[model samples]
Target chain A: MEVKEPKRRIPLVGILSGMISVASHLFRKPVTVQYPEVRPYEPERFRFRISLKLDDCVGCTLCEQVCPNGSIKMEKLVRENPRNKRMLYPDVNFGTCTVCRNCEEICPTTAIYLTHEFETARTKNSFLYSPLELAMDEKEVKK
Target chain B: MNDQWIELNIGPQHPSMHGVLRLKAKLDGEIIRELEPVIGYLHRNAEKLCEMGFYCDNLIYFDRMDYVGAMNMEVGYLEAAEKILGVPPPDRAKWIRVIIAELSRIAAHLVWAGAYGLDLGMLTPFFYCFAEREKILTIFTEACGSRQETNYMSIGGVYQDFNDKIIQEIKDFLETFPKRLEEIYNLYVKNDVFLSRTKGIGVLSKEVAIAYGVTGPMLRASGVEYDVRRAEPYLFYDKVNFEIPISHKGDNLARFLVRFEEMRQSLRIIKQGLEKLPEGPYFNPKAKKSMMIRLRGDGEYYARTESSKGEFGVYIVADGGVKPYRVRVRSPTFKNLSILPVLSKDVMLADMIAISGSIDLVFGEIDR
Candidate 1:
């Protein structure tokens, strides 16, 4: 008669995985990074924060229109220059900003665009950006 | 005399399915004889749609491919379009993208871990996963206006910067998450029922996984060292010191284990990125040369990134026109999901759900 050999068992298969989860508790230096002191390395090309140079902007309102979630709005501005002529700048709402960069892409003069500095969190409800912060002239405009 | 074979018609809209998925199974009492998946229930023809719109317009459509990890999917496409446009975003933007992408990965895994638990009849873990996910999504909402399909990563960089308040929120989340993960894992992972249901079931050898073109946790479960973030470094992944979790078992349990480890690694990557945040321009200031962005007819390039699911590749073939001549999207869910029919054969009927969940198919991306 032929003898049937016994099947060898594979022992402790998923044991390491369970242990690794437990071992993580020990000697794991605080993985948390203190904000500001140890800031996240935002890439030079990261498209987080929105910054505007206003000088490169035109009154096309493409940025306002192309926004996916309607986060950006372009208000017509009347600026007093040397000749007392009127100029325009877009007023942005950080609260509603989707960060899709629709304004940056649609902007004719590239004045309104996304910035690599993605560090703009605020606790106050009234900290939204206005036309003055995004326009060439430092004066706030509501056109 | 009675027939032994039984024909089971699993409907197109099953609750256990990841998205819209249909399976036709042939059974012999409790054992499955064969299984066939009828896909494309939600096909939007994403590739063809991408060819019709402007480069920026296309990114929005691409974002919906992997809805669980929409931002990560969009970033790869956004980068591809910018690469072809011959514009390199500032390093600060790239670093921010990495931080957000890693965070997005954690968010996606949270959903997966929760949904997987729900599929396996473990109700508590799913809720726990979602509760933690809510915290992550809250941070995402502050950074990028919308909740789920956040169009956060921009063409040249991100939509906004991470201020002190948001950074502190991330810090709090990181410190609390590892403990949260342990709490949930201890409940479900080591449980005898959970292991019995997953262990030694739906086994896929490492060689078979490679043949199926499966990447991410599924491939890593089979002991393959191929992560797009590591092999082809994009953003600031190179600077983050972390290991790609892997397992030799190559079974349903291994896939679950791989995702668990990846989540831990994601926290490490996020911490590294947060520490290295730079101060610079988030948007490009160069003057626009034209309203319409034309394409080059000379050469075609393929851009891919390691999304939460797996690899998302965008192949853009331009003919020197604003619209692409042809576009092909290689979604990881579509590729990773096809392995189901092969594994489902000869497996028990109850175990089929575990196997299918382990494959992690999102029909939206698969059909697209």
Candidate 2:
């Protein structure tokens, strides 16, 4: 196909206006948040790391069954709830977890929940959370 | 096989090729003699992987398929899955899906515009377009949890409901977005360099586009007014009143104009959807629980949606089991990218980038 040259408009007017428009942005504050120092606010429903309520969990193993990636494994805990006979709580392997909130939604007693803990990266490859570790909040995870 | 003809490979990793697309072009001096698109560099085998998991597990994979337009991708898969189960989402949920999907289209177009500008060596508009895109991502974050790979849409309906805060934020966005859009449009469209670079750069004929199975904005840019939302009318698209912008020019500039107009149309659709927001449950009450577990189906179904890049479709074959027998994606980018060799033939080497960038190939969807 032959290349056709369209009717061209003068660049001077467009160039000056473009420069002025860009110059106007100079006064505005930079939108970037300082990482490792200032943390941005996450919304209430933000899905990040998984947490489980030890008391509320009935050990039905529904969360373990519902997990798509086989991240959740039902393990027997030493200090079990007296209400529960099975004494099995879900231990989530975060290395395999997709954080899709399938377990949180499928939980029978609102036990498994997702916290707004954005900083999930660590030195270790294995991020398996035991029943005790799963019960801790974001503040505790930071500690 | 001329003595001066040189072979050039422009990235599975280069800056301008868009995602992981590599163009193997035969160059006669600066003019391209032949061009072959080398795909599968970013392939994750999402189709085969979908068959391994439960029906619901495939939703996350859909999210990654078209990360820019995840809502549209999810909607396409869910539509196919819902067809097998013989249940549609509730009215409110349908409206919510329409609103969110349109928002995603605008967001996707914004990314395209920013990237296209960057490809053409204009840095100012990229930042401006992304700044506006950030506002849309913020709305997505508030409505659903995540911003870009938002697994917001579910099988029966949506995972979350729209609260008052989210609604208000959308309204605020609708109000401010037009001015920002105009600002960004003026930054580049009026500029002599952007106009000259893109105006007559890549001219795709109407017949060639249709024969190659091109759909969405690219097809519309070639003056083929075929949009899945208008033609097929999925979700609440039939209920909403919107226009499909078409340009007969069929050049890189025409594609840019068509996409920009599409963003405006998306804004219009969102406004209408929000205005006619119904009061009801977001999820289909009957299919909600059963769909999460073993959604056994005996037949095959195909579902297509007007995604940002083009017609994103999902074809599912189920065999009365927990897992799908087979899942195939009719990704529009794949079809849209097929015509690249045709368009790139005999064009200037520099203009090849403009043409390819205008086509908007997301390797995730194209290679999936």
Candidate 3:
């Protein structure tokens, strides 16, 4: 049995091409985005942490209904409003959230939305927020 | 006989194995006499997860199966669900899907090229390849929110519309990538050392490639013109004008060249798709947002899409329920990796790495 050697290319040509390719990029600016210091820009529509506009929430329970990961649950509030006796609002568990933003999109009142604040790392599971806490924060902002 | 043959196990942990592929090879001196590939370390029961969830809920699982080509993975599932429901995506959505899928192809190939170089003892191409892939990932993050594992494509349409910013970034990438690709070609593809290492090593004949059911660039390298995009045109693939790159050599170098040409062709498809992108709703208005997306009737449907790796297919059986009765994924990497033993036969120990790298295995999909 005879073994045929593979066809060879000119080493000079290959060497020059490799050298030239590397040399051209040697002087160009680096493509690395310096994080922490530079804080890479996230798009406006980028889904990160879930946020709620408590005033606009109609207690529809749509966010909870559409959440595939079961991250959002509609819980009845202690203080019932006269306008609607069924006072339910969303409590979000960030641990279970895949951030698919299905809840945000399904919210008919546009009360539920995803903010670009992805820095949600914490030492405790207490980072999870209930609708009451969200509404309280809204009230504080208004004040 | 036992003393003459050395049994070598190459890893579920080795870096060059390209995911958790463990190769058990029987070596006689420096030459591999027999090689058996042991896979399934990264299996996450992706198909089973899909079966338990609604059609919309399965997109994330598809993303995990082939993390390098998440958009294409999502496309496979979406197409399967669309087939079962008898729903067609909007015109704008189809074009957007094509653009996203082709970008993913480029990204996957970039990773392959980089890692293949690394396997063959070249380092610079890895950085250059990743640098370009980062730009593509940035586009993905802007469009779909996540860099990797983007469950962007839905059954009715895509998750979000392609805004002007994302379109502009894609255009910028299209313009700058060719020059970078040329540098990659020069750095690794045309390098003397790379050529010596890869050229003519692990030759798979066209007949053997077909017999082993190899697809994607691997099959194309063996002179087969069978591309899922060209053979069975899906999405806007038929509308676009691009040639399926093929090589006759059927060697490691041939596979590399085929992928190199494919990147160029993908750029062309993206350019054409962008130019002809229609102005309309990105998602179909009729497609319901609820998790319980009931199929029209009880039926079995299969949808195959040309993923970056190869023909990624989704098979679904519906029993008139929101969740599928059974969901099966036909991953390209699985089919492609099956040919490794034949390719590795009688090859030198060092050449085995070259052979494996050329195939471009993603164990996540294979295991799934």
Give residue B321's lDDT in candidate 1 (0 to 100): 70
What is model 1's DockQ versus the real complex?
Answer: 0.06
* Candidate 3 lDDT by residue in tens digits, A1-143: 01122346776787786777778877988877798888676666666777777667778776775566678888877664554357888898878888776776666777887766676655554656778655444334233
- Each prediction's DockQ against the real complex: 0.06, 0.38, 0.31
lDDT of 1 by residue, A32-122 (tens): 4698789743333445557677555566656654554456766666664332133555677777665656666666667776655444555
lDDT of 2: 0.84
| Runs off by more than 4 Å, candidate 2 | A1-8, A82-84, A123-125, B289-291
By TM-score, how accurate is candidate 3?
Answer: 0.91
lDDT of 1 by residue, B1-368 (tens): 13777888775877788777888888899888888888988998988877776665566777778887787887788667777766567888888888888888998888998888888887756767887887777787777655667777655666677777778989999999999987776655656667788888999988888998988888888878789998998777788898888788888888888888888888999899889989998755431323324333324768889998888888877777766778888889888878888888898888898898988777778998
Q: Best by lDDT, which number?
A: 2
Interface Cα RMSD of candidate 3: 6.6
User: After superposition, which runs of candidate 3 have C-alpha atoms over 4 Å from their true positions?
Assistant: A1-9, A55-66, A73-89, A125-129, A132-143, B291-297
Candidate that scores best on DockQ: 2
* Better by lDDT, candidate 3 or 1: 3
Number of the top-ranking candidate, with TM-score as the measure: 2
Error of 1 at A6 (Å): 26
Candidate 2 has a DockQ of: 0.38
Candidate order, TM-score descending:
2, 3, 1
